[model samples]
Target: MALPTASLLAPGRVVPPAPLPAAEVARAAAPFGQSTMLPRGAYQDDQVLAWEREHLLDGWVCVGRSTEIAPKGMRAESIGRSGVLLVRDADGALRAFENACRHRGHELLPCGGSSQGTRAIVCPYHAWSYRHDGSMIGAPGFREVPGFDTSLYSLKPVRVEEWHGWVFVDTSGQAPDFGSHIGQLESVVERYDADALVTPVVHEYDVEANWKVIIENYQECYHCPSIHPELCRVSPPDSGDNIELEGNWIGGNMDLRTSAATMSLDGHTEGTVMARLDEVESRTVMYVAVMPNLLISLHPDYIMSHLLTPISPDRTRIRCSWAFPAEVVEREGFDPSYAVDFWDLTNRQDWAACEAVQRGMKTPSYEPGPLAPSEDGVYHFTQLMARAYQGQQA
Candidate 1:
């Protein structure tokens, strides 16, 4: 057989169906403050989605919680155009592999389910089985076939990592070390004891907007005073500041009001402060962005996470979860209703704003706008997107 071309193996290398004009491309490559949005087509075009799936989404994404796939558990998720399987082996180690059969390219495991004590992964089509480590275990009958080697046909593997009980997978298998990239985050968040926290509340929303709109809304609070009255009452809009990092992460801090102990509806904590936090730490809210898909907000009493998933050019899914100390949640009569209710209202407000922006972008008069001084985080995010879409690794 003839050798495959580089373009065949790396889809990102192929020319985009609808490429951005040269002038717009140059604008995107400029510094954060100097950069502006890509053309409106970049947000509503199918060709742009195809290019993004290959270059951006293939890098790394936070899929689910570690507890969801404990030892001997198996789950599947859609990454880009391919389905990926996440499995915890009998040894309690997590691994990710492509979810296709070696023989006929049929889907091996279903999208969501427990392995049910399955010893080996058997393909439903041809009964080809693979071990937990992705080694070929058995094939019914192939002894007479020429040049057939079971050793060469083991299942393909993807990169998976666990951080603070959250599971992340890299489809391209080229992502940098997770810890090395965001290790500085521990200095600011170690006091929160995130490892001891358990997520008990989750909110799912399907917004009619591009994924970038959601991320931009999150990185800046310039609209908080106008949109989120309750949020500004606690963490004032002007009280926030961000620090750009060298790795695939961004860090920032916002000071809560003097009388506020937490981010509840009334700016008070009904429970005790989080473990190990000093006086100042207890009154501040920290924001961290783990590039490509994860955003984390740490409070003195709890932690909140936003996972952005793109469904199409103009549709995105937002998964938000709130986690508190395991002991706090286990206590009887403990209600987090205040915090939940406060954020619930605030989230819907932001989602509405994003949807409105999406609708505006479809108009013929839409044009890229300049960034405000306080919207530094949005600028950084735009820079990252521009780099990735232009075939540069982020």
Candidate 2:
């Protein structure tokens, strides 16, 4: 059925979908963000899939959680729409795989790779085996088979790394190295030193909305003033001059209500957290939502790590973690929940917005609308998605 669009469109926004003469794909998308917004399902189109496979998947995908996996071959899954295995090697290095067995691709078949310890991954169906490094190690009666080259069936390895104790995995292998890509975000990361940290509380949610809607919710604070009363109390969204956003999110900054010079991972509300950021938790708060699925949020007393996973074009899963300085976590009377109220509340507001949009998009008027100049970050995301589909994969 032709979904309605008039209801979602702004006052005099998108008209009916009149087909346009073909032009360059980038130029075609120009109208979506510039003269008009994209039509409904732009987020769900097959062409968009083609673009993501080339640009996004080829880019870095975050797969980081340091303390979740134990020292002895621990395994954890970041179920962000996709099930990615976060595995720690026997030697402590973190590795991620597609969480499958070569024999009929079952996720449950394993003997040595179990809850306690993992010496090897044993498949139940055909007994195929793989090493921690993602190499295939065993295959039943392979020596007697004619075309049995076990070397060809290695477990596909995804690029993985740890930053401030957070483990990150990239399925696209095309993303710059974790260290290099993070270099662009050094100011916030260097301030937090999250790679060496540990999370005390983990939070996850399944919301009724598209993943893009959730991302747009995270990127801007324009709605903070009216919706998040507590957030406005502690850190007014209008006062977002605290942390400056670079690249696509330029001009915007952390809108902490205080005039503190900087914030750190530990949530300290004073000092030059951005300077000499090697070790001190001098500043009080910081936030960064990396492309695709990860958000790095820092507060004075703790840190909130978010992983945005898409269950489908319309549904999303948000994974959150609360990490603190190990000593503080070990201390008695340490309450991470005290710091969580602000984010938890803010997230609720965002969720409401996401649901509203999802419901509104079902109306026909939502197609090809206008852009609010203040929404540069969100608009940029749409543009990037469109541009990614413009060319053949480079």
Q: lDDT (CA) for every model shown?
A: 0.76, 0.57
Residue range 206-294, candidate 1, lDDT tens digits: 99998878888888888888888888888878886686444566657899998788887889775668979997778888888776678
Clashes of 1: 0
lDDT of 1: 0.76
Estimate the TM-score of every prediction. Answer: 0.87, 0.76
Tens-place lDDT per residue, model 2, 1-394, is 1111111111222223322222433443564235344455645454443334344543456554767676546464543223456566778776777767766787633311335477776666777888777788878777688887888887777677776676666665555456545544555566556665657677778888877677767766777676776666655454443233332221134544444332322333311233234333433345666666677776554568787766565677787877766666677766666656556776778888888887888875665456665555455555544444433221
Candidate 1 versus truth, CA RMSD in Å, comes to: 6.0
Count of backbone collisions within predicted model 2: 36
Q: Indicate the residue-level lDDT of 332 in model 2.
A: 75
Clashing pairs in 1: none
Q: What's the lDDT for residue 15 in model 2?
A: 27
Off by over 4 Å in 2: 1-38, 44-55, 74-84, 108-116, 141-152, 241-252, 259-284, 392-394
CA RMSD of all predictions: 6.0, 8.3
